[model samples]
Target: QLIVVFVSILIAFVAYTSQIFVLWNSLGGAVAHTFFVLAPFNVFIIFIYINYALTCTTDPGTVPPNWMPDQNTHFEVKRSTHTARFCKTCNNFKPPRAHHCSTCNRCVLKMDHHCPWINSCVGFENYGHFLRFLVYVEIGSIYLFALLSNRLAQIVEELHTSQIRPSATEATFLSINMIMAALVIICVGILGGYHVYCVTTNTTTIEGWEKGKTLTMKRMGKIQNVKYPYDYGVMNNLRSVLGPQPLFWLWPRTMSGTGLYFPIN
Candidate 1:
């Protein structure tokens, strides 16, 4: 997992370096134009790294040891039973939306998933950082694609107009970088878009799966109904995950919550 993280960072650095090389050497872009283009790109890069580090290092909230729920408190029950949810493996009462992560060998609060790339469970505490990292990666991928496309077009134009061709090394580097950028766009587009939907709907990836299961059971008449209690409409749902202020939605900060309780729809 550490190797994967290191390799991912190295690839990002190489991609950034490749873009600079194409801008200065291959495209021969003007200094002013290059700086203007690189400014926002550099910012996005920094944001990506910052969020990635936070996501990797932050501790997703855990169930306090020897904790138990109040008898009168309404809690998510075990399947069709009214019993409070419990983790047999951890021998503790599981909070709402909490789940035991086999990878981490502990119960996590509102755990979405255990990401191998970061080697951490993304849960209530770190979800904001994870989402921000995805957003930055998506933006960076698109920017890289556009920059590479422009450089390629210029090379083509120069070839046709003056019969001037790029060196073999430059052409090879451009081709490789373009392919990588395209893959990043496709993969991250799907992943980031899915997470965006999850946030807007106030559903984690695990809960999404459980929702599907309940729907299927309802169709078979095995369950009377299915309900997700956390969805508070689109805007409120976004605020639940990204914080209440729209302006700071992109900032690295967790929403206010203990993760043991959540308001219902």
Candidate 2:
């Protein structure tokens, strides 16, 4: 989980830093450019985080078998439809929102795809970064598209105004730029589509299997259904991803009923 968060932060840093450098170059040695450039990046970062939060997975059956309400503890565990259940695949009880990832060798909460780019699982911890990356990536693509389009337009304008034919080197450069822009557009389309799917349905790739049409337990919490056992509200859902914290929803070993606890019918 920590690894996921670190990797995501790293990715965001790279994107923001690279854009800042570009803006600096465009500003031509103006220190004032820092403010103009950083503000949008900041806004983009927040936007990315909110978008990611909205689409994060909320697995219903992640509660483990050892879980039990602790009356002895200060916090009273509320009776709810949420139950502690077992995953045959994991061969142990799981916390809510946690799912077994064959690649990660353990379950992750609100698990998104294991991003090869980051070399880490996009789980609850770094979900914010994942979403940020998506947003920035789209922004970057748009930026590149505008840049290439403007260059092409300028070339066309030059051709119309002047009798000189296009030079071979200039044409080759334009061709490369067009090709790069096209690739970026395609990649953005695919990523944006997938992100949209994940957001409306609210399931990550690690949790996507449970979102199947048949309404299997594997797919139960993907939709916003009150009938589902673990329909915790937005706060719980968010905590489910970020950390159980005082709630002890994540793996709290010493705490009673950490892994699996019977549901209060």
How would you encode candidate 1's per-residue C-alpha lDDT over 161-193 as one tens digit per residue?
999887776787778888887888899899999
lDDT of 2: 0.50
| Number of the top lDDT candidate | 1
Specify the highest-TM-score model's number: 1
Kindly report which residue stretches of model 1 are placed more than 4 angstroms away from their true locations once superposed. 26-30
Candidate 1, residue 256: how far the Cα is off, in Å: 1.3
Question: Model 2 over residues 1-265: C-alpha lDDT tens digits?
Answer: 5554674574465444444433333344457755664556566555544544433332222333454434443222213534444456666655545656677566654456665555556655555445545655576546545644655676688679985555565466556645654675588668866765564444566445544543663356644542434435545543434355734432212212333332321
RMSD of each: 1.7, 9.8
Q: All candidates' TM-scores?
A: 0.94, 0.51
> Model 1: which ten-residue window has the lowest total lDDT?
20-29
The 10 consecutive residues of candidate 2 with the worst lDDT sum are 249-258
**Residue 232 of model 1, lDDT score:** 92
